[model samples]
Target chain A: MKKNASLTRLFWTSFSISALTFGGGYVIVSLLRKQFVDKHGWMTDDEMLDILAISQSCPGVIAVNATFMAGYRLRGAAGAAAAVIGCIIPPFGIIFGLSFFYTAVKDSPAVRGVFRGLLAGVAAVIADVVVTMTTPVIKAKKVLPIVIMFAAFVANFVFNWNPAFIILFTAALGIALQLARFFRRKMAQGTGDR
Target chain B: MKYLELFWAFFKVGLMSFGGGYAAMPLVQTQIVEELGWINMTDFTDMLAISQMTPGPISINLSTFVGARMGNLLGATAAMLGCIVPSCVIMLILTRLYRKFRTLETVQCVLAVLKPATLSMIAASGGSLFLLSVFGGEPRDLWLAGFDWRAGFDWFAAVIFAVGLVLLRIKRVKVPPVLIMLGAGVLGLVFSVLPAVNG
Candidate 1:
């Protein structure tokens, strides 16, 4: 529908973008902004960010979902196919190639040493992530969310409950809270009208 | 049979993954590592670390890595296919219902709750990996399972984690994870030579 670019070009654009970026998700989103907004002039920066928000909110790999949406926006289903295929090929190929060597070296003592170190390093990074994630909750100073956060952690870590259930349960509770708040406000407004 | 099982497990991972790449970690731990027993915790975490250095989404990289580990090229293909199908389908459904989908109050509410919830998931996964890597046991096992205390701890790993934490926690510098990991690996190599502990 938009037709700013051909299918092949879209495919290649996605492929090159997917291939080049190291850290996925946010990194890809930034590149998308540059490509679609800066290079091709296909969409405004704000428009691209809106697509990104939807892509992130949806349940999937951000890259695939974004490309699907972007491609659909551009040229419909066929465009989506081309773009996704391009985006997928590089990661699949790169990982597939690395898997062989990793399998061979994995059990070696030296590799084991590296693995241990990598684990600690990853833990540290996740720790940093923990700070990043919790700061907003701390700032909000809402007791319910703080309680929900700890409860979710306990359910998974202590009880060994599946993270999926935790997500679903918390979402349900959150929605209930939102509804209750909505009703409270509505009742308040009704009383004011009287 | 094996390929089908692998595909199904990853499919659920793709479906339940709410937030993004890191959010999928706990799902992978539950599905592939714990349920299916395709790989152990060490391999899972190790592969995750390697994927951090690679150029791809963590889910896809993990699916391909785990699949290739379980079966082969065809198996990897199947697992990947399973993973992507749900994502594509869900997105397609949203695309069709695009007008009303984004504005849905429930969607916003769920996401609001999930933001912190998923972060806890990441923290929990990180804690488990931290346990296995340094302490050689989970909190439950180390505490309730009568696991030996002194024998379970790894000093070098703890030190590496401590140092890396200090370095990584400094948010303004924007240090790359791979750099700290590689440096820690070298430090680990230095400790590996010690007679008693592998570190």
Candidate 2:
């Protein structure tokens, strides 16, 4: 099929994107948008956002999951495989190579110093992560979401609750709220009909 | 047998880490540090720093490092596969049902809740990491032992942390994070050598 030829192109594109980006999910995402939307004109911004939402909703790395979604959307199962493998291979290979020499390099005083310095930098980046991640939630100005966000933080940091349990509880809470809203809307429609 | 253990451990981490890599840190910490005892606290933090510098998901990068440390190339392969397979399979299945689920009001609400919850988890992870880096990764008992809390703290790290916060958060410096990290590493090298010279 003609799709098969495109699949190889898709794979290499994903691989190059993954290989070049250094900052992780957010960086990779923006690069993906550029290639798929601006350069190739294959996907619209809204479609990309929708795919990103699906990727974030699932459990995997956002990069890998997005690659899978984009690949599947373009050319189906085989395409998905190509894209996922292409994206992951570079990072996997690099990290694998580094692992072999990590012990040797890690033992040096200078290396230890560098890693120690990295600790502060990591802290700063994480602090930014907190700010960026929470900004949208706060801007939404929804009381329930605001409350849930703080509650989750306290439960996690202060109580050391299992993250899985916290996620489950929030999911249940969301479902309950949605169910109640749905029933209320139905009741209102029923009254109008009568 | 060890390879199997590495696979299963990372597999659970892959399946359960909901928000993303940062949110997964706590679970990864517990698994690798507490349960498996594969690495110590210091090494874990070092791995985190290294993983951040690497491309891809932090989880995958970490799995690769941990696996290689345990069993060379074969171990690394196992860990990497374990970390990803669950997600790959789940995504494949979900991709099929995605059209139906995306339209559901319940699914929307669930995602809405998950976004804030996941953000909160990331915040908490940041807090714990800050404490660990500043306090030298000792258990709480050591901190509570007496009034000599300074004994357990790493003042160098604490100072660097404050400087970094000021540079990025308050000054709104447009520097990339990797650059900042590298600068701090340079500072670390200088400081390490300084003590040797002075003492």
By DockQ, who's the top model here?
Answer: 1
TM-score of each: 0.92, 0.89
lDDT values of the candidates? 0.82, 0.79
Lowest summed-lDDT stretch of 10 residues in model 1 chain B?
A: B190-199
Candidate 2: stretches off by over 4 Å: A1-5, A184-194, B98-100, B137-147, B170-172, B196-199
Chain B structural similarity (TM-score) per candidate = 0.89, 0.86
Off by over 4 Å in 1: A1-4, A178-194, B189-199
lDDT of 2: 0.79
As for candidate 2, its clashing pairs are none
Docking class of 1: medium
By TM-score, the best candidate is 1
